[model samples]
Target: MEKFFHFVSQTGFSNIEVSSLVMLVIGLFLLYLGIAKKYEPLLLVPIGFGILLVNFPLSPLMVQPENGQPGGLLYYLYMGIELGIYPPLIFMGVGALTDFSPLISNPKTLLLGAAAQIGIFGTFLSMLMLGFTDLEAASIGIIGGADGPTAIYLSSQMAPHLLGAVSVAAYSYMALVPIIQPPIMRLLTTKDERRIVMEELRETTRRERILFPVIGILVTGLFLPESLPLLGMLMLGNLFRECGVVDRLSKAAQNELNNIVVIFLGLTVGAKCTASHFLTFETILILVFGLVAFAIGTATGVLMGKVMCKATGGKVNPLIGAAGVSAVPMSARVCQAVGQKENPSNFLLMFAMGPNVGGVIGSAIAAGIFLAVL
Candidate 1:
């Protein structure tokens, strides 16, 4: 009986707390959203599983080493995040997979991308007014960029304590791009604006494609050396894709390297959401502030599209402006979907990609500014 009691006491049921239980449910909810709803599954699946693994009562998964005891597996993998390694590598993979032709074809849309970043600065001020320290606000502010890796990297730098909330908020908003952006795109634009069809992108020459990344790195590196870690990797990846000489390297960056880093990044980020860390009043505030930041970014992107539409004599589809968030192809697709709903002939995907990639670069620059100034 004594042995039986001791054995039972070692189980999770015996050690559970209210906070752990709450975290467990939250983890399960994330899982459902990933697996069933098919939303950002590659990211959410690992992250959700990590949350479940770490939240178990008396779990050793995230425990630090003590005495002769070895630390948990995730404790070491999490160093990638702590040391600021994974996000930049993720950026490299992003570059490897991304084509810069759209952005290069429509350099003017770069302004739309820059315009969207106002949300980050706007949110920064709001968080400060709400009593967050400058660093905490900075961490939360990047969530407006809707770039998960950038948000994670910046949070790890500025306020490591807020990483989980900031990451979850950023990725969740990224996934919600389709849902949140369409209404704003419609509300801000006229039916004619939504129906505006863009000119087909001119064919980018092989030399131009190759030179784009090279020039991109030089310009951005000169302007914001602090951003090189992220942007440098991104440009390197894009160079691999465009150079056409390193197919093997490009494939590796796009697939193997990206997949592995995402798994580690997602899982480790989720592990950071231990009940005590994630359930605080501050976490709640971060989520709320993060949402507002995203909304502002989407709004500003659309508004900028309108401005450009006016400037370009209706050549620009105002909806493409909404793609200025760094959610990548997702935001671009949402713009296409919203625009086509009004006019089936409208094909905004290629056009939206211009601002989409620009948002990626713009967000990285914003992070650099924060890192440099702060």
Candidate 2:
């Protein structure tokens, strides 16, 4: 009986054990959000599972080997993340999947995308005031751009310790865009402004389609050398799609390679969510600031859209301006859904895509600027 009691005491109820269980519940909640709510499920599900795996009592998935060398799954995943390989690879997939015709048809929306990045700078200042060092604060601030890969890339370069927090914050807020953005958007714009209609997008020529990636590459390479890895990979993927000679490669990059990398990236990001690192006051602060950053970006984009609406004689739907945060089609879809709520005949999807894609590029540019200045 004494031996049994000793065994129970030895095997049960400790802080790491309790924290691990708590973290497992958190992981399950994240999984529920992904599976049931479909909140960024592709990445979030894997991330949630990884969190569970790493936090399981005595789990070996993320721990160093007995030989005092690191050879775990998370260790390997961290290799790509640490060297900044995953984000560029992900960018390739994004570029291959993106259609740039909307931006080509309505070039003015690029300005709205640019305006949305004000949140990045704004959040950076706020973070600095909150006591983070310049580089760390800058990394946290870029989460406001609502671009996960860009946030990961910049955090990997500038403040690696903060990577997990910043990436999770960026993605979480992105998933919450439907919740966080609509209220700010509604508060800022009137009912009539929400009902504003824009002209349909004109068809872009094949020549323009072919020229865009090439020009984008050259201009980005010349002006922002720091963005080469991201912009270069993105343009390469775009060229593969537009060049008309590499359908197989483009498809593989978009589908297969993207899937594999996402799994690895998601798990690796979750591994960083170990309780000791993630369940901190700073983590809460990071999440709060990330939401703030996203809200500011959304507001700034809509305000810019309102300005353009007046200038364009109400041809621009200010709601589309809120799509300027770079979650690709997700932000654009939110804009469309909200616009349709105002008027059934409203069609803002294509117009929203301009700023949507531009937001992607704009976030990458903001990441580059953070890398350059800080």
Candidate 3:
């Protein structure tokens, strides 16, 4: 009995405690949100499961070995996240799936994307005042960009220890955009503004479509080399799609490659949520800052849209500006839904896509700026 007890104590299971149990419950809640609520399931489900696995008492999945070296599945998974491999791979898939024509047709929408980034910078300054170092605060601020991959990529580089909290915060707010953004959207715009109608988008030329990805690569590469891993891969995927010669490659990048990377990325991110790392005063602070970042981003986008609306004599729906957060089609969809609520005939989706894609590029640039400056 004594020998058996000693052996058990040497393993991870013996270390199971109340904190671990709490983490397990949190993981299950995340899983429930993903599976039942359909809240960012592609990432949340895997990450939720990973959280459960890592938090299970003495699970070897997250503990260090007797030799004092890191041990378990999570350790290995974390390597990919730490090295910053998963996000760029995900970007390649995003590039393949994204259509640039909507953006090209309404290039002026790029300003909304730029304006939305004000939240990221704003949050950075706020976090610094709250006592986080420049780099750590910058990572926290990026939650406003509303781009999960970019948030993860920048956090991995700038403040790796905060990865679990920052990533969870970024993705959670993204999933809640419909909830969080609508109230702000309604508050910021008048009913008449929401009901405004715009002309249909003009058809984009094939040459323009073909030229976009190339220009994106050159401009991003020249201006922000640090962004190339993401921008380059993203643009490459777009080129494959627009070139019209690599249907197989485009399909593979969008479907197979995307699905696989998301799984790895989600699981690895969840692994970072070990109880010791997650249950802290700092974690709570990070969550608070994340919400602020997102709110500011939404408000900035909407305000910019209002400005554009006045500038364009109501031709631009300020609500479409809120879609600039790079939550991709989701933000755009929210803009469409809200617009339809005010005016059933109003279709803002195509116009929203301009800032939607621009938001992606904007977040990447923001990440690069953080890397360069902070």
Best by lDDT: 1
- In order, the Cα lDDT scores of the candidates are 0.93, 0.88, 0.89
- Pitting candidate 1 against candidate 2, the one with the higher lDDT is 1
Selected candidate, larger lDDT, 1 vs 3: 1
In each prediction, how many residue pairs overlap at the backbone (N, C-alpha, C within less than 3 A)?
A: 0, 0, 2
Error of 2 at 185 (Å): 1.2
* Model 3 agreement with the true structure over 1-374: per-residue lDDT tens digits: 99999998877677778888888998999999999999988988998999988887767776555677757777777787899999998999999999988789989888999888888999999988989999999899999999999999999999998999999999999988889899999999999999988778889888898899899889988888988988898899888888999999999999998998899899889999988889988889888988998888888998999999999888999998898888987999999999999889788888899899988988899998888776
Q: List the residue pairs that clash in candidate 2.
A: none
Minimum summed lDDT over a 10-residue window in model 3 is located at: 62-71
Q: Write the per-residue lDDT of candidate 2 for residues 275-346, one digit (tens) a residue.
A: 887888888989898888889999999999999999999899899889898887789999988999999999
The model with the greater lDDT, 2 or 3, is 3
Stretches > 4 Å off in candidate 1 = none
Reference-based lDDT, residue 136, model 3: 91
Model 2 stretches with alpha carbons more than 4 Å out: 1-16, 65-70
